[model samples]
Target chain A: MPYTSDKPPLPETPEQLRVRIPGWGVDLDPADRPAVPRERFDPGATGAHWEFPERQPEERPRERSIEHGTLPPVFGTTLPLRGVSGVVRRYAYRRFSEARAAHWLLLMAGDRIDVVESRVLAAVRGRPDDPVAETGVRSEVSHHGWSSRAGAGRADVVHQPMDPVIVAGPWVLGGLAAVVVARRLARRARRR
Target chain B: MRAMVYRGPYRVRVEEKPPPRIEHPNDAIVRVELAAICGSDLHLYHGLMPDTRVGTTFGHEFIGVVEQVGPSVERVQVGDRVMVPFNVYCGSCYYCARGLYANCHNVNPNATAVGGIYGYSHTCGGYDGGQAELVRVPFADVGPAPIPDWMDAEDAVLLTDAVATGYFGAQLGDIVEGDVVVVFGAGPVGLAAAQSAWLMGAGRVIVVDHLEYRLAKARELAHAETYNFAEHRDVVVLLKRVTDHLGADVAIDAVGAEADGSLLQHVTAAKLKLQGGSPVALNWAIDSVRKGGTVSVVGAYGPIFSAVKFGDAVNKGLTLRMNQCHVKRQWPRLFEHVRNGYLRPRDIVTHRFPLEDIAEAYHVFSAKLDGCIKPLVVPGPA
Candidate 1:
């Protein structure tokens, strides 16, 4: 089976959830009064007036297994490079270029591959345990935002929003240098 | 145009909703003529199915006159009367090729668990059903079959889900020439299954239900022995006693999650929604069948885990078979039966309500009121 369903439901607001999951049959307030008497029916009588299901709706057993989907957050970050005479710059360029190329390929393919550990896989598989239970993100983010997870007990699963300019600068410089190098080689070949 | 929108648990209202339009190339829009509130629809109405969103329409068993058709729709056309199978199966899939239309792989985005089911919440492909003025049918040619010229609209609609499911339940029992079959629940599906059991050559058939009206219907319609579980001190013990303590050769559970058994279990599971559903009828079916007997389950239940007697079933060496019925596969044989006067599928419909008054129809069916054995919905003036 696919780890997680590709189709996630539309976001259900609290307003909708309040009425739906409460398990109360619209008894809090009768939305509409029945024009016909709420009289019981006789098994043999064929003429019980039904004025459109104006009554409140209730839930029954759903045969299929569609549950609330919890998706791992997808966010991006950037890395800054400090280079003397573009030495480290060239090294960072190769590494970051690989990452950009991979990103481009996935975008072209119009699909995403989620690679997580078995623990995270449990949530995707719709099994009992979930990734959120393994890691408490809400409380961790509230106090320090991104720095708390980096503290003593946990040193992983940090969320730091990085400026895209850092990666964009080196990428642009590398592209310009490549273009210059290509032009010179082309000119030399033409002269030869 | 009005559709029965499910707002919350046990709360249904008819609201003006925009009719469906063709969203895919193989899709066809059917202006629903005759629809039925299926027993399984109660599951959605009660909020047992997960991800059953509000604004979801609930009828899966419906017949309609085709209003519009996408370019790729070939089998059904505009103005044609068609009875759509509850399953929205793509014809060319690994499962569909093997005639397992209910397990078709290429339809539902969530194909891992269930195939496409119309109006059956998001878990079953999230396809909208034919309960409204217009419904979009996917893979239209494969799923919707033309109504046999001589068939009644009521019979055709029932075949879309309940009748087909009941017959499939009997077929899964693998009934032999003289096998005794005990069917739990005398609802439309149970009645149909008991009747179908006879066609499958079962020598003796017994129908069990808590309702007097339904048990009486079973006695009259299927000509089978009837047992009122409400009357028996122990229904399972009584089944064993009546079957010479060997139990019946086959037992079919036609009652799904909402079945009543013990008060505590029913309160927690069916009422509280703690577990899937009170596994009362299913457990009884398991216990009532003979050792090494076949157990066929057609009753609809929530996908969540339930406290079932799996250990006992394994120890008894019983063969268990179940699925959402593959409706198209049973159509040919059912058509023959209907034509030959062997089965009057339409005779079960006890009440009919306009699409405008579906809430009352649902209430009548859900409450099992006024001997509403099977209630059919009239969508438009047809």
Candidate 2:
């Protein structure tokens, strides 16, 4: 997935994929594709000087999609893979082709995991994320939060009921856990 | 010839490279005089875009003297000082005929969405950019226009992309007279959008950004109200309060890919690559606009999924208009604006670097060092 030459093997053979998924290769036939006629395959027409442009030296490992034969000539080294989220991202790139939904879904999951990791790290550094302020809860009251949505017939109105729970569920759970721990510590202190 | 070569992300160097030659009948080779680094170029610099080859030179906004022309080329000749539009398109293409040169289907192999752009990734058609001594422009007759004798060279260079794109952003907003417009990201594009909003008869224009220096530049250059988003507890709420709790009549997103409002969004999209771009500014634009108002997006984003609050736009009945600016389409009006002294695109230029020192230039620009707003690249002797 990151800094490797060999192509990753697909989880399933093409034949297996074809049978497992319905209409998996629907656009494989040129006849079925409307734009096939206009899609010209002319490499020389681009007038590039080199067959394969010179590869940039990789100072560190970099992410490459499984679909690519090798890393692109240049890649970002700013954000290196790290932590549990990194492991999830690595698994996605290594195990799935970009064409697969799993690859993208895993990457999205990794992003969510990264948020948790960041929150934990921030908490450890004594700069815990403020859910009330960061989440824009204060804006709701001050900036016509309910009235704006009440009769507006918004598309997101369908999920408006769930937004608060989705936003504050984890924070509520964390607060409850802290309260329980504090109570337990108090009880033990009294017993001593 | 010397060109800026992408060694890797955050790594570029000025290297000796062969000068570009006309490959197509409509191609023209232009000796670059002035080129400006675009905010979008930072996408390539940070390796956010896919298929950005190492040796690719990243510049789209450039003006130069034509050195050679292909046999079939017309409307332009050698020795003419021309500013090439960032778009490379065949004039006769369906999109070009409709004045949508940015969507011209013939130039780029991946022509489902955008047309060819110089010095962008292979996804945009692997034509080298103008951040070099020379650049080969395809469909030269259609794209490059002679710079007016009275026009400043620096102004012409900025028009190639930045100014044009900004003007286009405001135009797309469809601003009505006395409309309040809020522009997110006070970079060159945002500044231009802010200024152009006034031209479009906007009553009030507010520019938003975290950087105090850029906010000051917005005030000085665009003559618009400025807000340091970092100072506000919630910029969107502040926008609502300032706009009389109805939100701005129009909101323009000039920040793309690497927007820095929400730490979570920046980490997820810009850092983690889970989404194509950080949608903070775009989301802010969508949120800060009044119900039934328009939102214009000129910020460059990758051709991938972004966690945009699309449902909010639909619910708010917002008109979301966006595209890569059809650069030439906006020029006729812009030229007049420049001539009338209503706009001065080059006022944003804060730094200039010779082709040899582009890496330092990029570093200074990318890191936002020295209050650098816009940096111009001089290919000739500096």
Candidate 3:
């Protein structure tokens, strides 16, 4: 269904779709559309030599949305699905329609997981993320952070209390986990 | 062939790639001469856009010489220099017939909302971008236009997307004579919008940005008032105070997803990916535009939920207009403006990088280092 010169058959006939979904073909009538005259189906005019484009060789498994019949002729192979986040994203694409909020929310959740994964990876590589500096907390202190908010009457103030938790919550949890791991290791060594 | 390849977020490198070939009868293989790093490409570079797979090249603004054309290609020929619009649309589709080429339903199978775009994510149709030695351009006859004889190549390249999109933004505002127009983000698009606002008979135009260097560019290039939001306590309040408690007649959000006004919005959207885009600038546009005024959005946001002030917009009776630019639609007037010396799209170019050094170029542009404003990538010897 992806990148074929031949138009794919509709999943449902127009009459069936119209009956099942309201406003399914509101723009189907050429009489009502101004561009209808130019929308003539003239394949000869297109000059496409092939029935479908040659598919680029897939170097690895790629994410294809469930709604699509196959992978596009050419797809990005650079960031193949890997780790836990990739599994979640793959599930999102495999199970949900693009129109569903669940599809996007799952992707967002995957992105958050990716952030944590990257941070943990960085720590393992001896370049731990500096939460205070990287989180813009330093800028908040130095760059008119309080004065700008005091009299500005900004709408974002309602969510101000949660800012710290949202920004610093992961770092705090990570620190606690590290301390717990270190203490357990120390106790085990003493028993040995 | 060599091209810029995406390794991951904040990681891109020049790598040897297979030279693109004619994929369809309407396709043409273009030997890229010049490509630009658009502000929106940063969205892909930052991993902000969904489905931005690694190994995908990220470029949309480019100009090149046609190396080979499919048999059916009539208008464009081999050896002709061409400037391709970022939009890949079948010109006969319903949307294209109405000159809304950006929304052409035929080109992209992935999304119904927008036509295919070069070098953007799979969402825009997974067409490879032009930041390479060679690019395969589909719908070649419809999308690639012969550069005017008198036009500079730099100008031609910029016109492909950045300049045209900016001009389109101003045109969308429908600026009347003596209208006070405010533009957010002094990137190439914002600068072009400010300049185009004047051409459309704006009485006054103002540009907002946190960078002093870009604000300086806005003043020198667009000849408009500039405001460093970093210097102001509240930029919206400042706009209201300057406008005598009313707001500008039109406000344009040229700054898309990664706007830096609010710490929360930036962290949540840019960092956490909870929202598709940070709506700080859009909210500012809604709040800063006078009641019943127009808020024109030329900024590119992902197809996801953004925390915009929709209720406020409805209450204020504002006309909100936005679209991916119909690039070729604005070319006639832009060509005239360029010939008349009313606009110079190439003056914004601050750095040029060869294809090999593109990694450094993206780093400089992304980090906003060395006062870099607009950077162009020059693919090697033809």
Candidate 4:
């Protein structure tokens, strides 16, 4: 059987090219062309990608202080302690995302490819001035495919492929569980 | 231990790096004996692939002798010579279960997008590659097969990637007897694909490339017709005319992201790094293939969007099949073909460089200098 996709593939008529793929310049021939105007590097990626939303400005510079919080209600604590644990968890999650996005690796010669912690990569990157900004090369590299987890790791996932399914295995299981719960509730209501 | 590291675009250097160690139960450390620089690696060299981190090494087509095996590695013991597929698959995922090892879900954290590839870039699971003195083979039991006594190391290394990918490209064509196949790109993989198409009962095969040297090599190695796209005003139109105005029965796009075409497309995509390298070759494939024909893409493209003629493809009903070749699935047939003398994968190697001269090797290959088609890299002074 031929493969089919529910989400229609890209379609741009010769005349409607401008309307469909906004910002995609007509010039596609490869020649000695001038540098792409900086504004042309739209993080929004209108042409090749139309569905992805623009990234928040705050996410660009990786210097935001993560407000790591802790539980203030140890034995009924003070005002400052409220929601502290949740904040800590959120901070931890962001750090985890950063670590995943970081290309820091642990390897000997050629034995294998494994990831090291983000802090270790940060230390190495610190010496050379943050390599990202230091390279001074800016292009609208964006998240790939359909990875929601790619949200914070946009730098890493931009070039990689991704499936649209999110936490697919667990998400499916949760849906199944909800269906079962709903069925059980319906049965109880009938009995009552 | 020393290995090639990506310093920047068009810059590479051999540097001392820690040797690979077994980090997983199924991992095995192999001391690389022979490594071939692949055409796709050029994409990395030219800074086409995104997330090609500076420190990352970039050799996927390689062979070596195992020096150590982790506890769970049972198929091969230490001190065995083996060929590892470019793919690092868990062998138990939904994709791997069906022989689509290239789409293995467990190995690469970015598996949602691309499969785990050894030593291409951080996009490929950040696995250090086999261009170094040592490399770790993950899922060693499932991925690395012992070298057949008759197969040469050079041929075995090719099977790991280029040769197999080419063969797979032909297979994707669904070629019937007397089919006319046209391959765009005369690089190593393109040459291999064209040659393999002949093996698949193609009555005619044509290779297209701008470089006279590469086209000559394609003619010589693939024993097929060659077309210099640059010499013609519109190569696609010429292809249709030559194929009786019906277009090719099957078209394979061996050139991926860094394709050169019209001046403006090259500037916007290749030079500007705006969209994934211009979809020139792919568009040509779509334009040159007959309605209801198959177009197989083996070229390496970054995940970023490219402005391809998807609408045309849909309207034409072209069966556009492509993937990073599942190397392990192609192994059985490749081995038989090698044993039967149907293929000599090593015959494509045109240059050899010591590990220390990798920078020069990269430069030579990148510049297309000295009629270079494929170059082999030795891990040590050779």
Per-candidate DockQ values are: 0.01, 0.02, 0.05, 0.02
lDDT of 2 by residue, A104-148 (tens): 566556645655676677579786654443332443454345665
How much is B245 displaced in model 4, in angstroms? 0.5
For model 1, residues A82-155, the per-residue Cα lDDT tens digits are 12312322232233332233322221121111111222443575742322321122223332433422332210
Tens-place lDDT digits, model 3, residues A90-126: 8887888778878777765665576667667757978
Highest lDDT: give the candidate number. 3
Report the C-alpha lDDT of model 4 over B1-382, residue by residue, as the tens digit: 8988775555567767778766656678899999988888877775666545556778998888999987756678888988988987766555665567787555554224667888876446657888899987777777888899999888999999998899888777877655778999988899888877766666678899877767878877777789888768899989987876778889999988877766555555554455666788899999999889999999887655678999989999999988888787678767877787667788888888888778767756654555677889999778
Rate residue B80 of model 4 by lDDT. 90
Candidates in order, TM-scores: namely 0.67, 0.69, 0.75, 0.69
- Model 3 TM-score is 0.75
Cα error, candidate 4, residue B318 (Å): 0.9
Off by over 4 Å in 3: A1-91, A105-192
Q: Choose 3 or 4, whichever is better by DockQ.
A: 3
| Pick by DockQ: 1 or 2, better one | 2
Off by over 4 Å in 1: A1-192
Model 2 RMSD in angstroms? 19.0
Better of 2 and 4 by lDDT: 2
B-chain TM-score for every candidate: 0.98, 0.99, 0.98, 0.98
Worst 10 residues of 1 chain B by lDDT: B104-113
Per-residue lDDT over B188-243 for candidate 3, one digit per residue giving the tens place of the 0 to 100 score:
99999888777666666889888777888998887678887877889999988776
The candidate, 1 or 3, that scores higher on DockQ is 3
